[model samples]
Target: MSDERTAVRERAEAVLRRLAGDGARLRDDQWRAIEALVVDKRRVLCVQRTGWGKSAVYFVATALLRAGEPGGGTRSATEESAATGPAGAGPTVIVSPLLALMRNQVEAAARAGIRARTINSANLDEWDAITAEIHDGAVDVLLISPERLNNPEFRDTILPRLAATTGLLVVDEAHCVSDWGHDFRPDYRRLRTFLANLPAGTPVLATTATANARVTADVAEQLSTDASGRLGEDALVLRGPLDRESLRLAVLDLPNPTHRLGWLADHLDGLPGSGIIYTLTVAAAIETAEFLTARGYAVASYTGQAEDADRRAAEQDLLDNKIKALVATSALGMGFDKPDLGFVVHLGAPPSPIAYYQQVGRAGRAVEHADVLLLPGAEDEAIWRYFASLAFPPEDQVRRVLDALDPDRPMSTQALEPIVDLRRARLELMLKVLDVDGAVRRVRGGWVATGQPWVYDEARLRRVAEARTAEQRAMREYAATSTCRMRFLRECLDDPEATDCGRCDRCAGPWFEADVPAQALDAAGAFLGRPGVPVPVKKLWPTGLEAVGVPLKGRIPPAEQTLPGRAVGRLSDLGWGDRLRALLGPDAPDAEVPAELVGAVVEVLKDWAHGAEPWPRRPVGVVAVASRRRPRLVRSLAERIAAVGRLPLLGAVVPVGEEAAGGAWGNSAQRVRGLHGTLEIPSELAATVAELDGPVLLVDDLVDSGWTMAMAGRLLRQSGAPDVLPLALAVAG
Candidate 1:
């Protein structure tokens, strides 16, 4: 090697040893990536397995770059900028995707003697100070979320400076940049613009352990661009075999969530160390955590819904071995680094094998042996379908968003919601997609049309959709395959060198019991069976409803609103979700309430009768919402409640037209319009309701928007019932 290359190599070694423990060293690929970044000054895409030290390459590169080239003397930050004619005037910038990932990265950076700061939604109060620190060159690494990249203040003013001044730009979890990526984020595409503005030869590095060959090529193409927006021919791609030998992989196809939870409860104590219990939904996470806690396991739920403080506390607890597990959703997926993590048990399969690989990669990082089990639930596909709906918007939705935007004036997402009836999250995602497509631009106020004619790539979207379907099928096949599960996943990732992992269950016989203990099963059944999630009364109307020509604005009057209600269970609940989903699923034949559901509601009302905040008054009568889809189901539930409580069953509140009844779509104001003065009591029903002396029960098959129950209850009250209560078989999540 040349003397200059040798010196750079020695410095990289020193940095790596510090970041890792004593006697630690880099693999050849790791050294190659560092060489490319610091010495060759080439953009590199590293696709290696977890625990392969992707972060080390960037941190060592940052140290080497910040310390100046191996030469006569280290240059000052400004002097280096002047000499190089570009690159960071300050620190390296990392576009992290998750809060948990950022926290872990910050700590890891600190151990390597690199001063790191994060600018994220959680630390808004500290952003100005952080910005100042970066400006003063006091920070070595700045980790910001992808969502933060598009912030008005950050994007318009601060990002260019940060981009131009960055010593090394790292896109961690780089798969998120590719639409074909399993966890694609629209915000990450903003890096295209961010990249275009960076100083030439800034040495960008994109790293991920999960990207397949296709995603690697896609992200590499993205990373190949320089500040001048010129795409290069080569992007120093470092792809490796993604096989974790330490993970003893297996799949447990339980009959349902109950059996899975029971198996977890029965076997958790047998697991070697503290680890994560993955769930499909937040409700499942919370439910699993609660059930495990009841079984004497020290566990907590970690999901997007968790408060930042609580999530931090939970993470620390697991790190400290203070908790046995954290039942979590994908919120805990990428960038969680725990070297000694001993196990990962998924309560349900992720949408795809690659996604499963990414999550299971969290375990067996530094251990000689770690158990990785996938508990494939019956409801896994349903959950997957629900999540798959959040992909890049269809052409019509995209066009709707663009049509709502005016190039002259920015419109906040809130203001555009009524104009275009998309939900907030979907709307934001659509806007981001449109922004990338050049149809609209997000500015200081909000988004504005760019007047750029954009074609909807229907073929491309169909390909993405098809790819997702293929992934789902692969996951199912993985569960059923007798071959090495690790090999199956590696092959799913399109690894050319995929081979049988001899340590996996298929290769070495089953490692876990197929049978859950009777005691554990009973316990799980009891926990799952005990149902009823409180349905908080909707009090306020959606904002901007009046400006959209709605008759009213602000809060709904107490007299018109129904009181806090009860549903047998949420459609997302692990225990009750399946039952509720079946009962309310589209094309589900509507009839009388099932006996089991009736029994569950009886228990709900029984528990309500004994609770501290019991019903304010005994229901004098029961009223069913006029149901076109499930008239029998609504009537049966009401009649059962009335018979059990010895209350009168007043006739249904029948509204005439579907236009007035409203389909299950639209925003709050539109729903109110559909329901407003639209519900009325027939003369016969009105006479019966008039004689009621107390609150009446309003029954429905489900409470999706809660508008049906709210309006129907108000009409019953107007008919002479003193107050109204809503009772639904299921509450849509």
Candidate 2:
């Protein structure tokens, strides 16, 4: 046994040397994991810190498994029988979470003389060829996104064959398998089915750096389950200390967004090397990147909304150290590899320490030292609440979705949007959960019911929500803790060997400057205070609107469409965002428009009047969309705009029934249906609009779905206004 172990270790080291360097060696835990996978053919769960070479273990194990050596004749009787299968018969299938991670793994595999291929949304056209290579036994590693596991074609045809022949199955970023994890994904739950289908004696490995004790146990349980859906007795778990010695952790409490922005601008260059600046929202990322660029910094904004090509370009620029930093959101997190990333700065605190650790782990991986700073804003809790609102819907919503799905025919998500109240993202998530539960199935065209009853599992969902709340509370405590910051994060992740690192702010005192330069502060304030985001015109009606009793479909008539408009700011903006949230939040009491906001509105109108693409003609009249919740605020905004622009105050478009009172909370089709016949021009207003000489300024307190603006503007145009221009105080992102 000892000699066999030595042989296995030698082979692993050789592979590691190729992947790393001539001097590379496997750590004790890495060797143990490789031994369990390649020699014992056992399932293993590895929870180690970043830069711990978890990937190295799997790559080496893949090499050893395909070579059919099994530690040079150390195989047991059962393994010897299983050896009847052809050598190098199958590729190692790695279910990864992000495209960036897949790319990194593919490149790393090549270093070990392994041929790797990926099939993701980005490489759809190449999937057929790649699958052929895998069948031909020419591919050593196959990386796929978690979402691809449920692809109708892949799941129905390709996955079963791969499961039967796969040499080793690896689940990277395995923490996502647990709903209790900070970044839980519903699609990851599909792995259970895949696991149940794998052939006997096939090795499996799950790797992650972010799971806490609860999440770790959850993931381990899933990994241990056998093909019969029963838990197995033996599964190896290798957990290591979570401390990152090279990281210098600190938290700077800024008074507001202005101070945080100013601090970044003044001190970004002083940070060790090129790195990432994380913002909580897309709007904030864009705003921060623009400000930094105007200040002569080489930076770019990266968000989920960015085009794939743009995201790739930004990532490459950052990797090459061509850009000072990439101002990004959580979209850039998870499996992004930059061994020498010098620093990571957060503009706002994440909802939990586990998530924060996962992101900061990107830095200090290869370097001797790296800086990690958190600038916790006062609005962090509000942002947390906003995200929490998108969590699993109530039982009624789930039932509605299931009821809408047909057993005999599939329904595309777009077709169901009019019938369901959930947003597209949340709805898709619900469908995935249901699919995993056997209540639904994704087909070639869309999704169909399975005629399987599914319990809501309310208790489990409640526990998950409670866990999220606790995580948020823990994050708040972390921001205020005077104890060792690194130790605190480790403990938050339930690291068994957590201890003070003696390098964080609380351990050795402040390592970052607290004060923002006066000039930078002024510049940041001015940049944030600068207003006006374009309100894009909706050119096409939402699909399947007729299903909701609205005849609208295809492109909206040009004459009925509102001109491109402007908003004073986005509700997700860094400057006026908090104030707008306060004024427009459900709990807030409505009142007349504040004078300062009116001034901001005037500034927006000024820019719109003379800016490059000015309104086709000066507005001759102003009209407000009647608001049941904020009538005073909406009317006052319209009145103020008319007074400033010297236009007549045309009466408001009135809502007719309770349907119109259904606030802007549903999908586009539902919103349009609610406002279709409900909003009409009052007789007096219609007469006034008929006499308008030029475009009418349509004013509202907020634009959420933009359906209200479109429907109201359509009504005005039908009533004889020559053109309609929308102006809103805030636009919801």
Candidate 3:
């Protein structure tokens, strides 16, 4: 047995050398994890910091397991004989979280002479070939996204075979498997089903760098459970200290958004090396990237909204140090491995310290020194609340979804959106949760009711919500804490070995500049102050509108369509965002337009008049969309614009009944249904519009679904207006 163990160690060392270059040897913890997976065939959960060789452990284990080496004393004689057979062991199935991570893992696997393949959303065409490779024993490692586990075809067909034959299973970014985790993903819970179906004695590994004690234990418990709904013996958990000695952490409390932007622009060149600048919103990321580029910096904006090709190019640009920074959002948070990432600067603090740590861990992995700075914004809490609102819906909403689903017929999400009150993204997320709970099943077409009894775990969900609130509170404390920032983050992760790194701002004194150059500040202000976000016309009506008692389908008639509209700014913009949020927030009091906003509106109109896509004709009149919530604001805005433009003040379009009272919520179909036939052209307004020789300007406080504007525009065009131009104070994302 000792000789066999020695031989396994030697093979692991050789694999490490191939993966990490010559003279590379495994750390004791890395070797222990590899041994457990390759020799002992026991489950292991490794909670080590980023760049701590977590991938090395898995890749090395894959090489050994595929090579058909002898098993340890734990293996029975029959099992040992099976293990010693020719090298035809099943490939390692790694359930990774991100495409970027999978790409890195595949590259790393090749260095160890292990063939790796990926099946993700990006490569749908290649899944068949990859699966065939797995079946043919021509692949050593197969990476898949957790979301794929719930994919109907993959779940119904490929997953069962993979579970039965997988030699080893790895769950990367395993913290997402825990509801208590900062980055909880509903699809990750699907792994529980996969784990239960795995053949017994299949070694499993779950690795993450950000799991707290609660998350770590939760993941381990799930990973060790058996098929009979029974918890097995505890899995081997190896959690190392969370602290990164190479990181120097600090927080800069700038007075306002302009200053934050200015400071970044002024100091970006001084940051150690090519790195990432994180923003809370896509609008902010784009705005910052544009501002920096105008300032002569080589930077690119990266967001979930970016094209996949653009994101890939931006990532490669950063990897090759071709750009100074990639201004990004949480989309770039996990799975991006740049060993020498010099710094990570957060334009706004993430809602949890664990999430913040996970993002910052991307830096200082292979470098001697890396700077991590947090620029906490006053608007951060509002952004946090916006994201928190996306959590699992209340019990009533969940039941409404279940009630809408059919037992036999699978319904696509688009088909269900009109019947359900949730937005498409939120609705899909709820469906995933339901699918994981066995209340629904994703099939060929969409989702079908399982007819299986399921109870809403309200208490558990409430606890999770409370946990999120607590994390937000902790995040605030982290920003305000005078103690070592690194230590605070480590403690937030429940790292038992957390200590003052004696290098953070609190410990070593401030290492970053707080001053912003006046020139840079002015430039930031100018960039942000520039207004006029295009309110894209709803060219096509949402599908299945006819199912909701509406007769709409396919393309909206161009004759009845509103010309592309304009908003003074986006609600997510860094400059006007705060003021707009205050003015347009649900709880905000209805009032007349403020003078500053009036000035900005005038500027937008001026820019629109001469802009490339200028309106064909100036408005002949101004009409307001009647607002139940902000009547005063909407009426005042329309009257002011009419008075300023010297155009006739047309009366408002009035809501005929309670149907129009439906607030801006839910999917497009729901919004259009609630608005259809509910808005009436007042007799006086219709007469005025009929006499108009040019387009009528339709005014509102905000544009959310754009359905209201579309519906109102249709009404105006039918009432004899040549064209209807929609304008609003803000455009909600």
Candidate 4:
């Protein structure tokens, strides 16, 4: 190593030794990796295990790179560091996961007189100000959360300036970038975008205590590293022993929910020092906390439902040892780096091993000996199965949404919804989620489906949102298992030691496994029969499509049983003719279901038609129209029909109210056959048969309500054949 590299390395080593005590040792490989890192231009993934001094690698690298001219003499260990100047000349920006870690680092740096600042959700504006100072050469080092960095405004307005003057980018808790890691953020994918915008030759250093090969590859790809072969030596991957000898992993099988709670109470009573209890829901967290607190333990609970400040304070209280134990949902311990924790107890089983490992790993951080306890019960398993059923969306729905938009012209969400079957509100949210995952983009007002909207391919993105839901379900299964909770978790995480968590419940004690129970899989099997035939839930009971003793008579309308032709007849009888003539004017028959709704429906339909299971709970809408031929009032109505061509359906019109006078069309039923078809007419002429569109729905009240629908339908028909279904809430007498 060069003299300057050695000096930088020595300073970093001294800091580590002082912090970790004299007995701490740095691996030879770690040192060599640091040397290579100091001189490299490419980004690096320092994939080391816990207690391997991964963070030190970046600090040393940062010091060396910022030191002017590689061979410069070493300054006194206590010399005041100089402030950065201009773009491409500033201190390193370390992007981390937790605010607590940032505050701790900031405090440590302050004591040494080194300027450091932390930026997270709580202090975004302040972070912006510190970022400004970096641009102006006023700060030496800055620490921030990935969420803050992911903000586009921050990227656009603040990052470019620091990038111009920055020395290095340090990503702590880097395991989150990997699928194998316990936690993943959809926004982490943007780190690639951030790196691309930074000054060339600026080194990127990632530090995480946990990662396997796949995770390493994920990190490599995220950092935009060239993984054509394998990781570079400069990458510095220090793999420590996976075995946590001092932390005993144990599992307990509870016959029921009652036993599970009792088990938690028992464990909390005996445990000493700071501990954490992870549960599945907000209620569980609160209940468990109450139980422990009532039993005389100083306990606190946390969940997403808690206010932001409350959550932060609760976390700090845990760290400050104000509470001896914390009963919390998994939301409580992301990127928490405190090492003094004595135990981690799962009131119920964790869903996956990755999660279990992450939670259990918290206990032994500051001390050598720690313990993790798992109590699995029946309710946990039910929750898991319930959640797993939400994995995928109906295929037809996916296809419809995709087809609604032009590949060239990205339509606004509002414009697209009516054309598809999806409810206006829900489809918009899914689009937003997809946009965050990079599968789509928001341009103007609508989401433009970009790249592959891969309804089937879940592995395309590094931070796949699908896996998150899956992991969540798996967590419930893990928590509910009577088997070795650790073993089940390992299986979920795909850990090689799947059945070998030696000290777990399965390994140490008698096991009682619950047999698989019967339940209907809604998204699976052929419950709908064949296409074009609507099977209401009540009708599907004979097929054994029952869940919880009764078929859920979902939102499907009772009129769903009427044949298409009958539905059309009923609408026509309701005087929709005048309405159609008034609404369509010259083009009543052409309007298709809003273009977006068709796409949405088609997307759902295609997914269902295909094998994609577990459709997400999305809102869908269908509109039907009914009308009679009214030549006297609107002449070009025929021309409108010719322009729009055929609609999806048409049935004999039935008349109601004053429009009922026209019973003549019913006689020629053979000519047009469709049911509950939309009837277009005017409300004022309820007693008259002034005009109509054939194969109509008698929308008596709607006909009187006015010409809006009929006019729109006319315009729709005038354009071309539309899938415009019709709708009428009531048929007035």
What digit string (tens of lDDT, one per residue) describes model 2 on residues 28-76? 9999899888888889999999999999998888877776755555555
Off by over 4 Å in 1: 73-89, 226-230, 660-670, 673-678, 683-691, 718-720
TM per candidate comes to 0.95, 0.97, 0.97, 0.59
**Total clashing pairs in model 2:** 0
| lDDT value, residue 597 of candidate 1 | 93
Ranking by TM-score: 2, 3, 1, 4
RMSD per model, one decimal: 2.9, 3.1, 3.0, 17.5
Candidate 3 local lDDT, residue 440: 95
lDDT of 2 at 488: 93
What value does the lDDT take at residue 653 in candidate 1? 88
Q: After superposition, how far is residue 307 of candidate 1 from its true place, in Å?
A: 1.0
Task: Output candidate 1 Cα RMSD.
Answer: 2.9
State the lDDT at 726 in candidate 1: 84
TM-score of candidate 3 on Cα atoms, chains taken together: 0.97
Residue 665 CA displacement from its true place in model 1, Å:
6.7
The lDDT of model 1 is 0.84
Where does candidate 2 clash, by residue pair? none
Cα deviation at 152, candidate 1, in Å, is 0.7
lDDT of 1 at 719: 73
Candidate 3 residue 589 Cα shift, in angstroms, is 1.6
Instruction: Assess each prediction's global lDDT (C-alpha) against the native.
Output: 0.84, 0.88, 0.89, 0.51
